[model samples]
Target: MAFHYPNGTPYNNHEAPKSKKQVKKQKSIQFGKRGMDFEEEINKSNAYYLSRNTAVIHKKPTPVQIVKVDYPSRSAAVIKEAYFRQASTTDYNGVYNGFYLDFEAKETKNKTSFPFKNFHQHQIDHIRQCLAQKGICFVLLWFSSLNRCFFFSGEALVTYWAEQETTGKKSLPLAIIEKNGIEIQIGIAPRIPYLDAVEQYIQSKKGVAMNDN
Candidate 1:
């Protein structure tokens, strides 16, 4: 069988099908070999949530400065040059269950720890501000090498981030994260059922506050 693009171009299918061993080898090297990046998975999960009327979340678009454009035809124009004007604050944000949900999705290849360098100071500051406003802010971290994911609180992450300068610690240890963060189980429908973790986190915070009182 042959596949063709919508434009009537025949899709190339000359390569031989991969064997089981070959597929396994690739998966070992590339985590799941699911063909979609971590961010894409999160986007699909968000779409799924939206479709079910569960939550409304969306990825923030990066601001780019267009420098040049080429109009090859009357109906189409091509962007010839563009540059990013500034750094983005976070990846995803929206209102979920009357709470302002904001978060950044990130993946790491490291098996032992997630490096602090993966995050920027501006992002930390932005999340901190949101947290101060009592917004539900956190990060979805995918530990690719271990095929594990966790929902880390923005408050805890920022607190560790501040310690990085004085303590000289470079990374967040996996053990520490496993203990403090909420582990998210991978699933088919939602992909990463992070909202479940969010709910759990909210309950835990409430419990702690009540204990303090």
Candidate 2:
């Protein structure tokens, strides 16, 4: 089975090179293979929000082009190869309290920083488009090792993303995230109760608007 990009180029998702310290720590904890699905938790949270009629968010589906398939006994089919229809933008998106919400979810084991290599150029371009339209765009970053999450606003993310080349920073530090993003506590009903953070973002936007006037 093989996968290709939309341009018919071979595609492979590879892990970024790790330092000796990271390798040593990884061997000790094996956190990479912990088998915890961060997106699954977000899906559960979305379900909870839907149940309460609070928001209508769904994970964005990636279109795949099936190249080869085998029909066995006319009962089932096996896909042999596929290609992505196009580069994806964001993860979850929907409407909440009359505001259009678009966001990405990410989980990292690094306690000190979130690697920028995890992101693609297409995603940043998409986020910029959404923000230009005044959309409520942000990212839900889960620090798996610490069991902590943060609501990293798209504006803040883009600012740092654009400065990467000049600043020579390969990752976004947790200290900066702590200063610009909203920390969210794990909860029961809505496991990642992110709307509260959205509310805060909205209020802050309003305050800025008022100040501008």
Candidate 3:
């Protein structure tokens, strides 16, 4: 018997119903044998930042309500049943250079555009709230198919999201993203060197403020 989701649909332990070895092989092929996921790369990057005392960012743990628990042994306890209690705000948050940082990391297989459905209203609202406090809010978007990554500003994303309601745009085109977002070069040590992009964004903001003044 296979495990079924709350919706009654059987969960495919693998993305496709493939054998364990086959799934492993496929993942190696997909990630060029490195087998690193976007979140994993970001985690590595965060760890690198922390090691040098540059920044302290961590992934926010999802809140879950444990409905049942099983104590198989004195030292081992397994969660028999659990459910998400509420929606999460974002993936990572921390402080760097006396600035509060908040961001969500997401990836898409789409080559031409990133679907707006990937983002939730609550996450958008949370970003807006952070921006109100002058926190550095942004999103790290990974285009897996294109092998590209970008640092997109929270304000621009919020603006585009608001326009979607009236414009009826279903996705953000790659061209628009290229125009507005900073491209992040994938690296080996830190994997996704996103802090460089953050620094650039901060400088750009300062330039705009100087011009305004």
In lDDT terms, how accurate is model 2?
A: 0.79
Error of 2 at 34 (Å): 6.5
* TM-score, per-candidate, Cα-based: 0.81, 0.79, 0.81
Superposition TM-score, candidate 1 onto the true structure: 0.81
Order the candidates by TM-score, highest first — what do you get?
Answer: 3, 1, 2
Q: Which lDDT tens digits does candidate 1 get at residues 1-213?
A: 232225654422222233445433422223334444576578878888988999999876655699999999989998899865555477689988898999988777888998887788878989999999999999988988678999999999988999998999999999989998999999999999999999998898899999999
TM-score: which is higher, 1 or 2? 1
After superposition, the stretches of candidate 3 with alpha carbons farther than 4 Å from their true spots are 1-36, 70-75
Q: Sort all candidates by lDDT, best to worst.
A: 3, 1, 2
Model 2, span 2-77: residue lDDT tens: 2222555332212233343543333222233354456657787888888899999987655568899988768788
User: 14-131 in candidate 3: lDDT tens per residue?
Assistant: 1223343543332221232234467657877888898889998887665568999999998999999987555558768999999899998877778899888778888899999999
Query: With candidate 3 superimposed using the best TM-score fit, by how many Å does residue 204's alpha carbon deviate from the native?
Result: 0.9
lDDT values, one for every candidate? 0.80, 0.79, 0.81
Model 1: number of backbone collisions: 0
Give the winner by TM-score: 2 or 3.
Answer: 3
